[model samples]
Target chain A: MLELQGIAVSPGVAIGKVLILDREGYRITRSQIDSADRHNELDRLRTAIAEASKRLEQHRRDSTEKIGVDIGAIFSAHQQLLLDTTLHREWERLISDSCYSAEFAVSTVLSRYAHAFRNMGSDVMAERAGDIRDVERTLLEALGGAPLQVSGGLGQSILLSHDLTPAETAGLDRSKIIGFCTEAGGPGGHTAIVARGMELPAVVGLGSFLHRIARETTVILDGFSGRVVLQPDEAALKDYRQRMEVRAGRVKQLTEIRDLPAVTQDGTRVTLLANIEFPGEIAASLQRGAEGIGLYRTEFLYLGADTEPSEEEQTTAYREVLSQVDGLSVIMRTLDLGADKVGKFTLLEPESNPSLGLRSIRLSLRQPRMLRTQLRAMVRAACGGKLKIMFPMISTLHELRTARMLLRQVIDELAEEGHQPPQKIQVGMMVEVPAAVLMLERFVREVDFISIGTNDLIQYTMAADRSNEYVADLYAGHDPAVLRLLQTSVDVAQAAGVEISVCGEMSSNPITSLLLVGLGVRILSASPASLPQMKQALRQVRLEDCTQIAKRVFDFDTAREVDAYLKTRFAELLPEMALGV
Target chain B: MGIHMRPADLLSRTAGRFECQVLIENNGQSIDCKSIMSILTLGARQGTQLNLRVTGPDAQQALDALCELFEQGFDESDSEVATEQTS
Candidate 1:
């Protein structure tokens, strides 16, 4: 048995025969063509372009119906390139002037443009290079080269490829393909997003391991652990089969407890909320038994589109979310656009260090008019629902006070405009920066509630960027320093009689959810998919036991030590939930 | 993220109907106006000034239609309004 480890982008398991999809480069020999055959060569190029255009349109229509219009538009872009009159003229020019064969002319012209796009220096424009190569591949296939057979041969197989584009990933035959693993892909790539959207088990960034495995080799892909085992022995196969059965059993077990409260064994009721981006996620959040949305990220309002969303448009979206949550608390965070997500809508000078630079609440304060428009929509949306406002990356009392002052202005403006604003709207701020944790007592006195954004808090505390694999090891949530910071925020918020919760990646895991409850966090928010297992984990443990675990973990100096202690205690205490974690 | 319109939307099919020889120039680089690849290669981001040159029997009509499209942000403004209408 050969075992390989990679980053898990989606969660599931599959054991099936391997179908290797080698996207090998096509070889185009520059053979000479006769001058008398120029007309025939031009006709051949035109026929190939027409065929490729037809196929691209079909893919566009198929993807538009399957995946949304945004992804479908990719094929439309490909179609546009296929039908480019200039491109055809360039191909004809190369064939007739240089006496080149039809395949040679097409490849030479398309590859030149593709190389130009690759050297364009902008990352966005560089991606167009891939689109150019995709068009070239289609035209070459129509010219009777190697064709990519997408369907008709596979049966319950796992796809192994060098890499897959978003278009190719979306076009996979779902009925026959069980899962997929790639030697090249990142967690946040569009292809990975498509994999997650299709709910496929996938492991990416495995480097190079495709050469050793052969077709029809029985392999096991574990998405949770990011392990792919090829040609497993009898014992290994039996073990994986048993684990799959356990996974199925766990899903059934979670469904039975979906309606149950996430209360500890000692009757400590913990509020389990979901972190959501769009209004459409509320139904799924409710289905997973989330008490409410703890973190309603509003960055999507300004991320993708060309222009800033108007007050009326923002009001409509906010109202839809408030109504969908059905009286549950919906805390709308103002635009947290900066850093990597600083799209075209929010205009800001490119800073050298965007993380510590103008971001989140800093950007909102710098552009208060933008904040006021959002605040106005939020105030208008708060007709009678339990709507709250939360500011992200709050580092000082002055920033929080200034933001609250803006909210007051919005409410007053609404009242003056003959709109009935809510009489008592709660306000909160994220205690993400280490400075906020240090002065938590002073900040808590001004806000109604505070939530610990562990993702940023850990990054700021560790001075490490988690996305940078070089420093990812340094960015740990279980570090003693991070625990002390969370301890400080929870203690200060409790003393000030303000609600304290954790709404970050750390709260998404069952093991960390228990640790937060032990550290005196009454509310916990994570992605909707993690709610059921977290509820199961919390239900299996006592408050006093969790408190003891936290007390012991705080004495450790290193994150590794804390992690080791927690893993042991988790297995000892929550044996029913031990297998998956 | 530049030129927010998708390639198909940016290179409107109306450009092909005209008999004019149209060219779009940016940063001293001119490309054929009827090609989506050319427009994408231009990399004309927001607030960029692109010179459109047209010459033929239908040059006037082509220039007017193309100018209006560029002024309207290549029909990208319509996406936001379309979403609001559906909602």
Candidate 2:
């Protein structure tokens, strides 16, 4: 029995036969079309396309019922690509000209398309090829019998894959699969998102186990810690058993707090909002008691579309969300595309450091017509809804002013078109850029409110890429620069008589939220999954000497110092751990 | 006929590769189903078909949307999305 310890990202346990998802590179090599018969090969390719389309349509049917129309559109778009004439023509040309096998042609083209993207280019364009390849490979796998067959009736097996691609993970039967452990993948990988969505227990980047842990080795996965123990000893068994009991108790406690208001023990009213990427998560957010959507990312609208969404389509999306979460404030950030959302979409330019490029309001201002169109759509949708507009990555008052000018232009257009627009739409900026936080005093006067986007702020502050496993040690959320920024943003906002809050990961962290509220943040936005715990944590403490603590933290240099401080403070404040008990 | 070019261009034009007559109306709205800028903003991609049931003002644009798919092959650019779209 082998025992291994790694980071457990998702939480769950499964003991079953290991079904390894194969690497696309090797599979492509094996399935290279080798026949000299051209006509027969064409026929084979066509049949495969038909099968892929049929399966995609079926997936659309199944998921549409579960997720809804937008997700359905994603599958439908894949099906449409299957009938793409250019793709077929390319395949024919490759077969005729290069004389390579069919599978080889697909593998080559898709791989070329997939790798064509520079991780630091225009996010929309950078992602275009991958999205295209994703579509291509989905079709190719159907043709080659590579992906679909891998999923056939393994019956609730714990997926052991060399590396599970996004498509394979999405294709997984979440009901049967208790968890997944992969040799390759990271947090930002699509596999991670799919697993998170499916709520499956997953631990990734576990080097070579297909040979070491033979089939059905009865492995256990700890998603919370990224730990995998094979054939545990008596002590390990007792530890996990006791851990399970604690988890169950925590679950019960959290569930009870889900329906409770996220208020501090001192009766200070703080609004809990959901920061989400898709409209699909809204239902879960509302179900979990989110006052409304703090950050409604517009990327998904662009991400899954075979084409850009029409103004009408954009309107429909905005309206649907507003109507569903009626009476709650919906803060909309326009096109927060930059270093992370790399793709080629024609309007955005490719940049070296996209993190500091013409993103957010900068991109929108460059494409005034596009920005105006989105704003018009959003404004038109806000006939009587509680909607506010937010500009991300704003570094100066000039950017904020320009973004608002465009907002006014959109409003004027709507008014000129005789549409009854909202009486007022509050303007806000995400204090995501360190420069923005530094300029909060000046910015607070210009915007009605502020949201601390801790993700980028931390990255920019520490100059660390949270996605890099090697540098993750430096990407601590509690680092002094990050905490100082949070504290300053809150203080600046309060002094300006403007509302300030953090809608970042720190806000969702049950422990960090203590520090956040301690710094005067009244609006906390985080993923809905973290809401219950945040609520439970908030109920544990009243206002204390946050000024002194913030001062101490700001003076500290490392995350370890901040973490140690928090641990000691938390242990002191809640000795029983009763809130999350 | 569609010209085969790099799709990674943020401004690849698509004016000729679509069905000029078949306008698939996007339910009660005026939309150019084919403009590259239109496609980009709408977030269209390789497999996203432009069914041009669009008529009236932007009918020709609808055809452009379909043909754009044929004209531009995929290219990589750098612009990471900070957040995904939520409903």
Candidate 3:
């Protein structure tokens, strides 16, 4: 058996036959067209364009219904590119003037644009090249070209491809396809993101060796460990089959308890919510039995667009999310764009140190109109269902008070416009900055609730940029200083009788969940996929046991000692809950 | 009409309903106006005069619309609102 290792993007296992989908060498050959047949060629090109546009429109509708509007927006952009007059005119001109075939002309023009985007040295621009190529392939296939055979009646197959665009992944037949592995794409690529949303077992960035595997080969794909074994022996296959059965049994056990509340054995109740970026994720969150949406990132509406979204547009989106949750509280964080996520409309000048530069609350306060527009939309949406507004990255009390003032102004204006104010509206702050942690008591009194954004809080506390691979070792969430800060904030919130929730990657981890429970944090929000596993872990430990664990953990000098102690304790008390550190 | 264009102006205007190639030439450098990256590379600030060239079946119509857009100063009214807010 040949073994390949890649980046594990989603967690699951699938043993199935392989379906190789190689679309690398579909190049257009330049051929001459007679002058008499030039009109026919243009007609073919127009028909092909019309067919491609129809297909893209259908894909956009399907993706919007299946995925979310943000993912569907990718297809919307593709449709816009297909309808671009410049691209259409360029290809038409090339076909008429150069006496080249329609396929050749289309391919040539698209390649030039794609190459230009590729050489631009920006990740956003580079991704556009993939979109251009996707459109080109669709048009070429419509021109009676080589069939880009990706779909068919395949039973229980793992799809292997060179790479997959977001549109392609969204359009896959999920019932027949068990898992997917790509020769390209990192953990952060759109393919991986969509795979996680679909809950499909996936591994990516395996390099070109994956193309060498023959079709219909029995392969074992372990997406959690990022291992793909081709032509597994009998013993290995049997072993994997047993492991799959175990996982299926575990999943069934978790689903049985999904409807039950996440309460400790000692009668202490804990709230488990889901962190979502798109409205499409509400179904999955509900299926996982999330009590509410802890963090709904609103920056997605502003990203990848040339113009700012209007208040009406933002209202429709927020209303859709609120309606989907069906009265479950949705804490919407307004437009956290900057640092690694600068959008087209929220462009800023290049900074040498963007992590410490103007971002989050700073950017929102600088553009008060933008902030006001979003707040108006949220207020309008709140009239329909439960909605809580939260300000992110508030380093000081001044920023919190200013943001609250703007929110109040929006509410008063909406009330004056004949719209009834929301009956129960809560405004909160994300306690991520170190300064915010120090003044948690004062901040808690002013806001309705507080959510600990541990990802940024840990990074800022350690003085390390987590995105920088060089200092990644320094950015540990288990650090004693970070835990102490978390404990302090939770203590302050509890004393003030305010609700506090931990919504970050730290709360998603099973071991860390125990420590957080011990620290007086009764609410934990994680990704929807991890909610079941987290609930299972929480149900296995009592609050008193967790408190004792936390006390011992706090006495440790370093993060390493705390992690080691927790790992050993969890393994002994709950072997099934042992997630390797 | 010769007109200067900013990055945002090019990004917003080039996606208009005209199936034609709009090329902008300045100081012997030329690139497609439809590409935001190309326009950004030009670094054309306010009042940097650019020569416009249209080539396609709808060249005349595209050129006319583009000239009208330029004559209106690439929709300066929106920028004026933003500037007013900041001031």
Residues A1-581 of candidate 1 have per-residue lDDT tens digits of: 89999877667899998766545344232234678888898898889989999999999899999998887888887888888877888888877887766776776677678778777777776777788888888988887665335345546888887677655665567787789988876554445544654657898878777655632478899888889998889998999899889888887888789899999988999999988766867887898899999998887667655799999999999999989997899878888878766656666876889889999999999999999999999999988788989999999899999999999988998899999868698999998899999988898878889988898899899988654435657878899999999988888888889999899767877888889999999899877777898999999889998899879997898999999998998889887677675
TM-score of 1: 0.65
Q: Which stretches of candidate 3 lie over 4 Å from their true place?
A: A1-9, A14-221, A228-238, A304-307, A465-471, A579-581, B1-87
* Per-prediction CA RMSD (Å): 13.3, 16.4, 13.0
Ranking by DockQ: 1, 3, 2
lDDT per residue for candidate 2 within A323-427, as digits (tens), equals: 888678899888865555533464555576766677766777787777777888899988878989888888888888988988898888778988886889999
Evaluate candidate 3 and give its CAPRI docking class based on DockQ. incorrect
Against the true two-chain complex, what DockQ does each candidate achieve? 0.27, 0.02, 0.04
Task: Go through the candidates in order and give each one's C-alpha lDDT.
Answer: 0.79, 0.66, 0.77
- Candidate 1 residues lying further than 4 Å off, grouped into runs, are A1-3, A14-205, A208-221, A229-245, A304-306, A344-351, B1-87
Q: Which residue pairs collide in model 1, if any? A: none
Model 3 clash pairs?
A85-B19
Stretches of candidate 2 exceeding 4 Å from the true structure: A1-4, A8-145, A148-213, A216-219, A229-249, A343-352, A545-548, A575-581, B1-87
Q: After superposition, how far is residue A80 of candidate 2 from its true place, in Å?
A: 30
After the best TM-score superposition of candidate 1, give how far the Cα of residue A104 lies from its true spot, in angstroms: 18
